[model samples]
Target: MVSYTGAVTPGGPAQTRQAGCLTITKLAVDPKMSNNAYLLQCTETDELVLIDAAYDAPTLLSLIGDRSLTAVVTTHQHWDHHRALAEVVAATGATVVAGEPDAASITEQTGVAVDRTVTHGDRIAVGTCDLTVIALAGHTPGSIALFWAGSDGQGHLFTGDSLFPGGVGNTFGDAAAFESLITEVSRKIFDVYADDVWFYPGHGGDSTLGAERPHLAEWLERGW
Candidate 1:
């Protein structure tokens, strides 16, 4: 049974929900950075995959409990997002997967070598479940989003620091970067996914594509 929690605030406690065979747990790891770490588990096989390690390795590990962790997928090489990556991988012995272009940087930052590099259309297997990697460049060169179609006929997207509720992620005040991110998000995310597709971002609360789709032009005009 799926249960809805109160609206997620920055640095709020972790929230969990069930969608068919998938169990999603969202934790706000870093209060300052407001980074979110997600645990995705397959109900049938009990195998799991963690998306972004953020901070507080012990808390994240405790959340996993006895479940088998298959891999740790890094959405980008941003420092704030993977601060606890090394610790989590060391404890869980989970393979580290990252985007090809950002693998070197991610390894350099975390000191944990990436076991696999994925590009667009790559399917990552988490026991009985699979997540499709969608390359979303702009917030960072190797930024990617994971898309999963659940048994409930709903789509779930894990967008790490790329696409957020109000608008796309910060582009470090770079016009070109903002343009690239907006373009990719428009074509890859908005154009491809349905309105009801729910997305869990790197920080803060969750939002649906339908909630943010209407403001595309507004976001473009504001250039954020």
Candidate 2:
């Protein structure tokens, strides 16, 4: 719904209907790249997980404080994806995680060491909700996605920039790599997520896993 309450408190707009189970807030950051960053909060346990800190130190800090954040997770190492990670990590004392290749870049940029370098089949447990990591590198060397499987049963994905709604991401720059990435994303979408799963891209509004699946044929036919 992308609801916005007041612009003063900082962070994303928050809504809590049922208590202590699920709290999801989607934040928007200027990311220095093409997309915006997101912050996910599990309010019941006071456990927070941020996906890409694309803003500055103060703004990120304000958002973290506003949400009672617990940890930070990056989908990739694009400048847009991690512009403010170091600052947030320093302020919150949160553990930062990224794909293995992105680990070095994140460290180089943020100056905050990455505590976890994940690969395919890795999982990040947040209270009862679990985020399973899947390598979907095409947009960059260490591009990845996080699949959230929880009681909601909706199945959510954080697809960095490899895949979007009706259209996939650009592949002209790194055609081979980008093609491989979209293929990987297609495979994951084909296997792990159900038709109803929600796909939250790195830059746009949300779409469904099922909704985008049929378009894969078109993507492939276009030489993806």
Candidate 3:
């Protein structure tokens, strides 16, 4: 079990960590966009779930070589987050899952239908391990985060564009949207989870809830 820093760069090798009974692999894809795609494999069953097929099919496919890909879970409807979606599904035949609100938009843009539309409290299993869906509506009508409460004290969260290291995801100057995102994050995430929980964002390196919790008030005041 190698140490998981959750640090990766475009074209660089992926970082894999053993979290409880799960094998988590984080890879930064799309050289220019710097998008990230994660592979969550259940160590007990070897069943895997790919979170956001953001880009670089060759790299993603290579990382998934010989493993069973149960499904591809798209965090949101963002174009950057699903660039490799159509291709990956075409190649692997894995089920496609997305937030119900944004599933149609994602299908419209990517030309691949979503097999399952999830909402808050929904659970998607990765073999023996399960990922609980946390809907963070703001960045998009259906932005979401995946929560895995590992047996270990610290849990793991896979936040799409809705939450990040420094602040919440971009709302594009829309105060209402920003409010929705910040409020949802503060209530559904910061309030619910403890500090030790690690969160992997749509892009860039990961951060723990504690590290970003202190900045919530500042983020709301700044209002990006």
- For model 2, the local distance difference test gives 0.70
- lDDT of every predicted structure (CA atoms): 0.88, 0.70, 0.93
* Per-residue lDDT of candidate 1, residues 28-106 (tens digit): 7765777888898999999999999888888889988888998999999999888889999889899999988899999
Worst 10-residue lDDT window for candidate 2 reads 5-14
Model 2 Cα lDDT, one tens digit per residue, 1-224: 43432121223443322223545555555533435556676655667778887676676676567555667888887677787877787778778888998889878876778899999999886656678888877777787888876576667777777678776666666678757866787776667679987667777567887887888878776754
What's model 2's TM-score? 0.84
Task: Work out candidate 3's RMSD over C-alphas.
Answer: 0.9
Better of 2 and 3 by TM-score: 3
Report the poorest 10 consecutive residues by lDDT, candidate 3. 1-10
**Deviation from native of the Cα of residue 85 in model 3, angstroms:** 0.6
Off by over 4 Å in 3: none
User: What would the TM-scores of all predictions be?
Assistant: 0.95, 0.84, 0.98
Cα RMSD, model 2:
3.8
Selected candidate, larger lDDT, 1 vs 3: 3
Clashing pairs in 3: none
Best by lDDT: 3
Per-residue alpha-carbon lDDT of model 3 for 34-114, expressed as tens digits?
A: 998999999999999999999988899999998889899999998999989999999899999999999999999999999
